[model samples]
Structure formats: C-alpha cells, structure tokens
Target: MSRVFDAMMEGLRGNLLRMGGRAEAILDKALRALWERDARLAQEVADDDVEIDRLEVAIDEGVLKALALQAPVAEDLREVLAVKMIATDLERVGDLARNIAKSAARSAANPPIPFPAALTSLARSSQRVLRRSLDAFSRTDAELARAVLAEDDAIDRAQDEVVESMLRALERQPTAASQEVDMIMVAKHLERVGDHATNIAEDVILVAEARNIKHAAKLARNR
Candidate 1:
C-alpha cells in the first residue's frame, strides 16, 4: 500500500510538470504570435488553451483522490495541496497567454502601430521570471523562489512605463489608437503572467518549508 501511494504521488508530480511545461509553451507561442503578428499562430494558441485547462482539471481531481484515499500527513499532504494551487496559477498563466494571443490578432487587423520597445523588454523579463519560478518549484529551492519574488517590482515598473508610452503615442496619433490600446493589453497580460509565476513560487515555499511567506515576500525583498 505504501508503494502504491508513492507511485500515485510520482504520477501526480509528472502530470504537474507536463502541465507546467505546456503552459510555459503556450505563453512562449502567444508572445511569438504577438511579435510576429501571425493571426494563425494566435488562433492556435487559443485552441491549445483547452489542453492546459484539461490538465488543471486533472490535477485538481488527482489531489482530491489522494486526499480521500491516502489521507496523507505532513509532507505528503503539503505536496498534494500545493500541487493544486500551482495548477491554478498555471491555468491563470494559460488564460493570460490566450488574452495576449487575442490581443495580437486584434492588433494584426489594424495598420502597424509604433512598437513600444520597453514593452518587449518587459515581456522578456516576465518570461525569464516565469521560467525561474517553475525551476524553483521543481527544485524546491526557496532562495530561487525569493529571486523570482525580487523581480516582481521590475515587471510593475516596466508595465507602467509601457502604458505611459502607449498613452502618449495614442494621443499624438489618434489613428493608431486601437493598435496602441492592444499594445497596452498585451503588456498587461504579460504583467499578470509574472504575477502568477510569483504566486507559484510562493506556493512552493509553503509546500517545502510549511511556512506562510507570501505576505513577507515584500519585506524580505526590501532587506
């Protein structure tokens, strides 16, 4: 029975990792479609979102089953619960990536607007943070999770600058207003991606250390 329980746990972990990898790919492809202005690729991303959604459902179901059957204690319980939370966060990332793809499709319909350089840079930063956050979760490294938390403010600042720049450009060129607004939406989506990744990192800390550090993340970063 113990061996059976352990095997189930391993299967659950593999499912979680696969979901994470696919979610990350969705974000990457969405960003690519946005940058390339490929409506076809954007639509593909929207379609792929269903798979990520399915994975989230499976993860939730697995956790519930584990709870009902194994009645795990301490570390086992923490891992099962934390996986559900991580799946939720990853699902949000998928949703945001779909939004980016939708925005990209809309922007592609209009004549090209002046690109916001800062926004692209911020997108890259968010992707890096997300990758690191997932890595931290896989490795159960709280310090790496802290590094992910430390990068949140940078994402916030970049989003602010991008929005301001887009607003100014819209004011000067009313004709490109629609596309400029789409740009802002894209930037905002990417910002939310960073937030979700940060949340995942926080969940990892809780799962590994059995401590609530979400509220204290900012204070730690300040130190």
Candidate 2:
C-alpha cells in the first residue's frame, strides 16, 4: 500500500506540473499577442482557456484521489495540499491571461496606441515570475520561491507606471478615453497574473519547508 501511495503521489505531481506548463504557455501566448497586436493570436489564447479549465478539473480529481487512497500524513499531506492550492492558483493565472488576450483582441480593432515601455516591462516581468514560480515548484527550491517573491516589487512598480500613463492619456484625450481604459484593464490583468504567480511560489515554499513564508515575504519587502 505504501508503494501504491507513492506511485499515486508521483502521478499527482505529474498532473500538477502539466497544468503549470499549460498555464505558463497561455500567459506567454497572451503576452505575445498583446505585444504584436495579433487579434487572431489573442483570440486563440482565449479559446485555449477551455483546455486549462479541463486541466483544472483533472488536477482536482488527482488531489481527491490522493486524499482518498493515500490518506496522506505529514509531508505527504503538505504535498497534496500544495498541489491543490497551486492548481487553483494556476487556474486563476490562466483566467487572467485569457482576460488580457481578450483585451488585446479588442485593441486590435482600435487604432494602435503606442505601446508604452512600462507596459512591456510589466508583461516581461510577469512572465518571468510565472516561469520562476513553476521552476521553484518543480525543484522544491525555497530560494527560487523567495526570489519570485522578491521580484514582486518590480512588477508592482511597472503596473503603477502603466496605469498612471494610461490615466494621463485619458486626461489628454477624453474622446479616446475608452481605449485608454481598455489598456489599463489589460495592465491590471497582467498584474493579477504576477500576484497568482507569487501565491504559487509561496505554496511551494510552504510545501518544501513547512513554513508560512508569505507573511515573511511581505515583511522583508517592507524592510
């Protein structure tokens, strides 16, 4: 029974990793579509979210099976809980990416706004966070998880800059305020992606070290 439980845990890990990979791909494609102003590509990312939803369901099932069959304890319990939490976080990340893609597709219909460097930086920083968070999960590297937490400040600053720039644009061109609002919304969604990535990284830290590091991350940032 112990061997069976171990094998089931391995399968659970594989499913969670696969879900993470899919969510990461969704974010990458969404960013590319936004940067390139490719409506078709953006729509494709939105459409692909159906698959992400399916994967979420599958991940939940895996978690259930692990709990029912393995009755995990101690480290095993932490691992299973982490998988469940991370799966939910990845689902939210996928949803945020899809929202960004939809905004990108909408922007394609309007006259292209000069893509601000701040917005571009925000997207790049968020993509890096998502990638690093997944890598930390895969390796159970607490240091890598902490690094992801450390980078959140840059993402937050970029988000602030992007939103402020859009607000200024709105004030300058009231007639085109609607388009600026859409751009701001996209920036907000990307910021949320960064947030979800941070949450996943925190979950990895908890699973690996059995310490709640999220509060520590916040305290360290303030210091």
* Each model's lDDT: 0.88, 0.87
The residue pairs found clashing in candidate 2 are: none
Q: Best lDDT goes to which candidate?
A: 1
Q: Which stretches of candidate 1 lie over 4 Å from their true place?
A: 217-223
lDDT of 2 by residue, 81-135 (tens): 9988988998998999899888888787888777778998888898899999999
Which 10 consecutive positions of candidate 2 have the poorest summed lDDT?
209-218
**Residues 11-76 of candidate 1: C-alpha lDDT, one tens digit per residue:** 788888888898889999998888888999999998999999998888888888888998999878
Q: Candidate 2's C-alpha lDDT?
A: 0.87
Q: Who wins the TM-score comparison?
A: 1
* Residue 171 Cα positional deviation in candidate 1, in Å, after optimal superposition: 1.1
